[model samples]
Target: MDANEQETDREIVPERLFQSDSNTCASVCGAEQTIRKDFLDMLRERHDIERHTRWYDIKKKFESDPRYRIVDSLYREEYFEDYLHIMKEEKRKERELREQRERERHRERKADRRDRDKDKEKDKDKEKSRKDRGRSRSRDKDRERKSSKEKEKPKEEKGKSEKIKKRETPEEGEHREESDKEERAGSVDSEVARQRENEAEQKQKEREKKLRAEQSIREREKEVQRTLAGHLRDRDKEREHHMREECIGHFTALLTDLVRTPDFTWKEVKRQLRKDHRWELIETLDREDRERKFNEHIDNLMKKKRERFREMLDEISTLQLTSTWKEIRKLIKEDPRYLKYNSDKGEREFRDYIKDKTMTAKTSLRELLQECKFITHKSSDLIKENPNHLKEIQDILKNDKRYLVLDHMEDERNTIVLGFLEELNKRGPPPPPTASESTRRNK
Candidate 1:
């Protein structure tokens, strides 16, 4: 490279150090004096004095002139190179860590395989030892049987000799009887006769006692049996009485239910009554009374069902899909707070109605109406453009509770819109749309 090119290569990048208020180049230059000539010689000779300091002076001088801006541009490319180097180091570190984890997994699998092989070898050795021990035990049993046969022959010969000696032995006896002997014999006979008489008497007494005791026990058993029979009869009668009362109570309740419904067949009602007497009595009620009760019951059910239907409708209305601003405006006019409907309130009311509960639609409708109050113009416009955008608007409205109450009224359900004309007719004519019309601008 030539001297000029070498000088350019060592050039420094300048920063925005000068305040806008001051333009005196002399004072600014004092902070970072620049080299006038032989910049390459200064760079080569100044190996120890911070190279950045010398470059800083060059940077300050070059920064003042717009023509030197291109030279300043090169510094950014170098700075980017440094950042790239740092990123490469980080990537290398991550790769090494992943490789280390893979090595550990490989080592674990190898060690487990080796352990399995060791266990297999140990089992083979144990099986061999068991077979050898079984063979040795069979040979010892054969030797023991041979020794026992030799000992049995000597034992049988000894037993025969002893029996012959016993047969050859003779007995000796004296035939004379002394007075003492006779007296002793008579005493023995007398003692034995007394013992026989005593035994007979004891047996006879025990038999008589046993017979008497048996007769008394039999009589007592008969008495107990009679008492038990009477108690059982009383218990049966009590159970029958309780059963009859339960039957009567059930029939009475069923009869009242049957009387309130004209369509209730006499045969069917009697079955519910669960008694022949109740069935027969129900068939005799006056036709006029039966009809009145039946009409009253039907009216009550219809009124309840109508209320439930209204609640379900309110819930269904709250389930809006994404709607455009124009659609929202129309919905608002029909029901001013319609866009503000609470999905929770609508869903809750729906569940209750489905479960046959009465009167929750009003609260849910009111919540929906209140939410319509907070609709921002931009969002409201967006909601109105998409006619099918009610679902999204409902979701936004349902999630926010800030619209639960309105500035003018607490109960939004009562804020009747054009859509509620049918319900409002029952009350009276609704006042002309005053503020309602203002909310409905042309798209």
Candidate 2:
């Protein structure tokens, strides 16, 4: 910064030292002139020095000078009211003392007048009471004189009343007039001050009432705005939900159409087609509803699996007696209905179904042994003629089991037949204990 700017920054000006529109330099400079620092300092010293002075002393200072006159009203408001109250109290005391002195002087004057009247009454009694001359004539003359005095008494009293009216002192009357004027002025000033205070209080109350009303209006407006925003939000959410539901209905129709299509006989393959078409549409549902619908769709996908199993059961009895299980399996898969049951879960379900269906058809182990013994009843040389006898028995069992069976992921139901045959081979053919032994036993 430049030096001039720095100097401008450092120079200080204190506020509230003088009122703006004071008439101190009205003709010479301007009413807007600021008080000099020296005058401010002088005022500060004068305030400390004269703070204890009489109110009239400060009033004289204010009334004589134009400069102090402006500050005088401010000073009276700020500090002079206490002194004003004290001066009024002192004036009251002085006036009361002056009235007391006047009352004492009046009392003394009345006492002196009373003493002089009593002395004139004693002298008149001394001069006229002792001698009695020409009693009857004196009595008549005294009566006539008394009548004349009574006739003149009213005029003399009127003259004395006029003299007393003229004797009222001008100084005392002026004092009473001045006192009355001061009393009237004091009452008017007090009334004016009281009215101004009441007006100010009423204005403040109005301002506070207006503020409360405005605040209440603002709060109500904010509440209405929040309520409106909430309603809009709810509307938006409902719109979104409606859109989602419409999309769901459309996707469900597409799935149904895919199931009705003629190609791909397996329900699983049909579902796969539907998935390829609208898989993204199904992802928007909530968790519980989504899982429920997904399971229902899966049921639809595997719908043909049980029908295919029942068909396999019906075909089991018609298979050739010489055919192996692999040959039977090959024939079964060739059917259009078998494709849906080819999946892992479908195949497992089919196997369990077969197990349940064959439960009633299962041959007892004792009955099966007896049947094997009967089949091999002829001789040890029966092997060459019946090389595939175990296969024959297996085909018979396939018929008994209703053909819907699986073992080791293959049609290995014939292994049970082979087990029975191996048991028959280990035990040599039972000897021909025929009729000769029977006859000897009978003798």
Candidate 3:
């Protein structure tokens, strides 16, 4: 009976230990993992090394419903301490994981808030001109954020680790142990901070890249606008050029038709045009454009006159030498041929003919003097000579093409001949021979 009671007490001890193990796990570890820990404690308590090796089988046997019983004293104080150490270690790991998650969330919130602030700052400067905007402002923003973060760090960091360590009785070797643990935690913190910094730098680079892409697109849009403006300017210039040319053509046609009769002089016709409503048509034109049109109009008038003279071809050929220029002029006017030489251009053509004919006649007269070294001919006397002399002079004048057009301008023919004689007088006969020249010639 005594041996059986001892056996019952031993069985009751295992039952109490099982119950205590469950309570310890619930209170400290906060997990259902207490069974595995209890099994380990069982191997430690047992003196059988072979049973310790077969840990899984022992766990299966003890945890089975048939042998299950609680024993409070089965796990000693040392086993409970080991359990406490294990619980502390597991809780520390869980706390570190939770802290990591909280820190990640904190960094994410800070980054998102900073990005929003950056956008707000960008919006504030949107009203400023783009030309005056400085790219240095981005660096300024980065520096400002760094300064504010540093300014707020002491208060924020102090509150973050606000849980104070209890002042307990000192243990001899605990200082080194605590210092090593703190150092490990600091190293982990520094590594996480370095990763956050690297991520921030990557985000900043991405923002700068997006800004550059947007700026390039804006520049291309401006270039396209400038090209369109240039095309518009060219189109306006071309339209103005065509309108100017059309104005000149209309003015010239009007003048050509006006000068087909001798009833009007060009000066009178031009002066009267202002009152004739014809001048009002061109009044809108600029001064230079109107002047260009007038010049073209005179040229058209002269061409018309020249064409009319050519139509009377028979009379021009017949009266070459026989008619005095005065009668030739009258005959040309009344001969039913439309001859009008009353324009400013007609007088201009007359003067030009006179100048060219004089030049040629002078050249020939000078050569004639060279040929007849001591001739007694006087230019004035020759011009007033008889028909025979006039005929002889006419034969000489025919050789040069410059004087040929004078016949076509029959009214100016006498004036041209007189001008030719004046050019000959400008030479003043010939130079009197010098003393050395006379002596050389006599010798």
Where's the lowest-lDDT run of ten residues in candidate 1? Answer: 168-177
User: What lDDT would candidate 2 get against the real structure?
Assistant: 0.59
For model 1, what is the C-alpha lDDT against the true structure?
Answer: 0.52
| Model 2: CA > 4 A from native | 1-172, 259-296, 303-335, 343-347, 354-443
Question: What are the RMSDs of all candidates, in order?
Answer: 38.1, 46.6, 47.4
Residue-level lDDT of model 1, residues 1-443, one tens digit each, is 89988776556322233433255677656533332122323333433433123233234444554434433365433433443454467678989999999999999999999999889888987887888788778877877886787688678756864665466443211222255478889999999999999999999999999999999999999999999999999999898776555444444445555544334554465455545444443354455644454456556644554465444344545433222334333433344233233445434444544343213344555446445643333443444477445445555554644333222343442233223423433555333596457556532
Candidate 3 yields a Cα-based lDDT of 0.60
Stronger candidate by TM-score (2 vs 3):
3
Query: Model 3 TM-score?
Result: 0.36
**lDDT (10s digit) by residue, model 2, range 1-443:** 99998776665322222433343446435432333322233344454333344444345544554445555354443445544455567678999999999999999999999999999998887666644445667899999999999999989967875675588687765786688689999999999999999999999999999999999999999999999999999999998898678556655655565554233434455357545645555556565654454456557655555655666656777543334445456666766566545456445655565565445333443255465434563422454577665456555555533433333323344454455555666775665778658877989
- Cα lDDT listed for each candidate: 0.52, 0.59, 0.60
The TM-scores, one per candidate, come to: 0.19, 0.33, 0.36
Candidate 1: C-alpha RMSD after superposition: 38.1
Q: What lDDT tens digits, residue by residue, belong to model 3 across residues 179-220?
A: 869999999999999999999999999999999999999999
In model 3, the runs with Cα more than 4 Å from the true position are 1-172, 253-284, 306-314, 317-324, 327-333, 336-443
Clash count per candidate: 27, 0, 12
The number of the candidate with the highest TM-score is 3
Error of 1 at 155 (Å): 47
